[model samples]
Target: MRLLPVGTTLFVVLTLGACSPSAPEVPVGADGRTDPVLVQGRDLYQANCVQCHGSGGGGGRGPQLNGGTVAASYPDTAAQIELVTNGKGAMPAFGGRLEPAEIEAVVRYTREVLAENG
Candidate 1:
């Protein structure tokens, strides 16, 4: 019979324990969009962003985002995606915490919800 070394068994167990499942992401469609994403994004932003950006994305601890100020300069989605994935100034990198799908949805939500008003 084969047996794993004690160290190997411990390492395997620890790794599995450390890597827990994150909150499930709202699924997007083939067209690559969904209102559910917005809802999820809203929930995420409320939990994660409201303290800094304010409930409406107005400037608080963070700068105002509801004015479409951030999204306008991005020539494409990639640029915006990069900024979010990587930490910039006060913004912490959410790369490990938020799945790529959630990030994309948040970006879309920012455009859809934050662009229209103050």
Candidate 2:
């Protein structure tokens, strides 16, 4: 006879489900920037963040972002913007490549995506 624990099965199922590729955030707010920001953020993240941060915003070669890393490292959104714009240790600055608006959009996307996953 085979015995399967309930909790173990549930954990296995959840782990499998979470392993799938993350879809972009849809059904954004009325403002194009708000929701579209997440969609655009997904693109920006795929292009930039994925190299370091995991596709799901989890830690990779760098550090985990879904936690308070940004909030702790940067005082506020502006600080995060500054870091992303200016770059930090090992991380390259993206200011020239992306416009301020695009940066904000990607920031919003990161936060939203983190929230959804967390």
Off by over 4 Å in 1: 1-34
Per-residue lDDT tens digits for candidate 1, residues 25-88, read: 3445578876787877877776667677776677588777777876777758788778788868
Error of 2 at 102 (Å): 1.0
lDDT of each: 0.73, 0.73
Q: What TM-score do all the candidates reach, one by one?
A: 0.66, 0.67
**Model 2 lDDT tens row, 16-76:** 9988766345444666455656677778877787778777668678777765555666557
Clashing residue pairs in all predictions, respectively, total 0, 0
- Among the numbered candidates, top TM-score falls to 2
